[model samples]
Target: MVMDEKGMVMNANSDNLPKDCPQISETVNLIVHAGQKYATKFNGKMFAFDQQQWNVKPCAKINITFINDDQIRHQFMIHGLPGYLYPDGMVHLELYGEGELKASLIVPSQKKTYLVHCELAQHAEKGMKAQLKVGGGDGDLPNISAISSPIKMDAYSIDWTMLKWGGMVILVVVTLIFVSGRWLLFRHFSRRK
Candidate 1:
């Protein structure tokens, strides 16, 4: 882990290999940007990684350059890795604001999909979620921004009963306003005469 005035990095493994993997199969260089602009193509998202998914062969060592384009903190975290190599089965790289960081990680020789996201409050939910596939991955992760659908969709239901009551109340208010306004006008004209 490396920390400075610029940014912070955690669980960045460059040379260590997962026990299952005998050697590094390939080297993949990735440049991922984080900001709201990346979420423009995704509906109802506030933040996102420039790309939603990355593919690598099993035992491939990925060298990542993470860039945060927004003026707020953002993170690039890959989860569900081998616990021995990555603490809590994760690789985390973060930027405090609009900055960049570089790190590396070696994936195991297993065909699986690992979750990648920012762990900040509502950041992942908002759209900073992605997926890293090793050897094409077993399947897709749910609710990956612009990649897959959520497990349960959010519903913004309009209650017809509430709408009916609100309309009735509005009608009564308008009617009262009209009647009072007419009465006041009639009284003022009668006084003038």
Candidate 2:
């Protein structure tokens, strides 16, 4: 782990290869931005990465530039990596606040989907989560913002019992306004004629 005032990069591998991979298939430079502005399009979300999903070839090396636009701490972490290459099968990049950090990791030669998220408290649940797909990925992860269906969706159910009377009152008021306007217009036209 390399940490300083700006940020930290942990378990990053640029040249190290996994046991199953012969060599690096390709190199990818990915720039990911994390902030509240990125979550504007998603309802009830306050934070998010710029992209919800990323696709890469098997055994590919990815160099990531993580920029946290918020004035709060944010992390760019990848899980389910090869333990031999990455300690604890994960690569973690974190910015203490609004900052940037560059890190690299080489994925194994397997068709699987890896979870990428911010491990900060309530960050992932609030929409700071994404998916890194290797070789098209096995399948999609749940609750990945607008990418897949959440395990437990947020329901905005209203109680008709409480609003039924209020709704009827509003409808009546609108109808009365409409009828009154039409009657006034008709009376004025008749008088003019």
Error (Å) of candidate 1 at residue 193 is 61
Q: What is the C-alpha lDDT profile of model 1 across 34-110, one tens digit per residue? A: 99999989888999999999999999999999999999999999999999999999998989999989999999999
Q: Highest TM-score among the candidates is held by which one?
A: 1
In order, how many clashes per candidate? 0, 0
- Candidate 2 residues lying further than 4 Å off, grouped into runs, are 154-193
TM-score of each predicted structure versus truth: 0.80, 0.79
Q: Which tens-of-lDDT digit does each residue in 1-193 have in candidate 2?
A: 8999998999988888888999899999999999999999999898999999999999999999999999999999999997877889999999989989999999999999999999999999899999999999999999988888788645677767779999999999999999999999999999998
In terms of lDDT, model 2 sits at 0.93
